[model samples]
Target: MLPRVLAIAGSDSGGGAGIQADIKTITLLGAYAATAVTAITVQNSLGVAAVHLVPPDIVAAQVRAVLTDIGADAVKIGMLGHDATIDAVADALADFAGPVVLDPVMVAKGGAFLLAPEAVGLLSARLLPMAAVVTPNVPELEALAGTQVEDEADLLLAAQELLESGARAVLAKGGHLPGDGDEVVDWLASHEGNRRFASPRMATRHTHGTGCTLASAVAAGLAKGLPLERAVAEARAYVAGALAHAPGLGAGHGPLGHGWTLASG
Candidate 1:
């Protein structure tokens, strides 16, 4: 039987991030993909222009429909845009006994805010506690932890704070840390222990859907029964491969080659 991963996120018109990226990453990783779209984004590789949120009840219904029917082994959540939607998702997932990978998608690559500021608190209160692992980039980590992250030590501290807050594990990404180094390090911290995964930063402007891709990849791994550390390691490798094989579409940040494995084989 194929592993099933339910992706709850927004729709990206440009197909670079959000539900589109999640589906692509999940399907490519050999997991069945399902989605409950929370918003519709007018966006391209350049930036997000506008957003239209889906009704909260509709989002909840979509989740319930999938959960009660096709089912899921894991869930990957991203870009819930509104407080009501967060509440809806929390309620819908109340009894879903599967691992969840939460990607706190706050800002688009073009500097547009994807998540409403008021909804942040609600998400932290409702969703963070349920996540098996929360993936937060530097800025999102700072916002969630309510602190500044100037160094790797700060990154670990903030991740620890999140673990204390509710998350079973936190993948604190240090790609945006102030440094001139050629490598990016992401820290995966859980109550059990901590480990670092580092990849040499590839020089490219085509990393549009990286966060979504990584979270979905991790969810796929979890759905396939890999442990957290192994799942994260594989996800990082997959994202690195995608980045290296970016399609270079559009003028600004371009989309990654999520279908790289197809071509590689």
Candidate 2:
């Protein structure tokens, strides 16, 4: 049977992030993709124009409907735009035992706030502990940890604190770190230890959906039974490939070439 991953996220009409990106990344990696859209954003590669949030009950219903019918091997969560939506999703997945990859999507590629301010605490409190691995970029890490992250060392330390708080594992992404270095490092911090996945940074405006794509890739890996470290490594590599092959569509930050593997294969 093909591995199934349920993505509980918003709808990016742009087809480059949120549920769209999750579906693309999961399917390209040979997994079945399911979704419970929490919000619908009027956006393209340029930026988010307006957002219409789906009701919390509907969001929860979508999740329950998928889980009870198709079933999922893993779950990837993003862009719960409201506090009530966070509560709804957390309650819906209370019994799920499979790996859950939590991408604390606080902001979009264009600086639009995806997650609501009041809901941040609720997500950390309710969902962080339940996640098998939580992927956070440097800025999101600073917000979640409620402290400043000056360097890679601080990034690692903050990730460890998240483990102490309740997370099973933390994939601390250094892509947003304060640097123009040749390589970007992502650290996987868990109770066992920390491992780093480093790759050359590509200079491009076509990384619009990289965060959503990477988290979904990781979830797809977990659904296929890869270990946490292996999943992170593969997902990073996949994102890199997509970045390198971006078609450069929009005037602003563009979408990744999520189906690049199809051509190569």
Models 1 onward score TM values of 0.99, 0.99
What local lDDT score does residue 11 receive in model 1, on the 0 to 100 scale? 98
In candidate 2, stretches whose alpha carbon ends up further than 4 angstroms from where it belongs are: none
lDDT of model 1, residue 101 = 95
Candidate number of the best lDDT: 1
Instruction: Summarize candidate 1's per-residue lDDT along 1-265 as a digit string, tens digits.
Output: 9999999999999998999999999999999999999999999987999999999999999999999999999999999998999999999999999999999999988999988888888889999999999999999999999989999999999999988888889999998999788999999999999999999999999999999999999999999999999999999999999999998899999999999999999
lDDT of each: 0.95, 0.93
Runs in model 1 deviating more than 4 A are none
> 1-265 in candidate 2: lDDT tens per residue?
9999999999999888899999999999999999999999999988999999999999999999999999999999999998999999999999999999999999988889998888888899999999999999999998888878878899899999888888899999989988789989888999999987889888898989899999999999999999888888899889999999998898888999999999788
> Residue 143 of candidate 1: its Cα lDDT?
92
RMSD of 2: 0.7
Which run of 10 residues does model 1 get worst, by summed lDDT?
Answer: 114-123
- Evaluate model 2: give its TM-score: 0.99
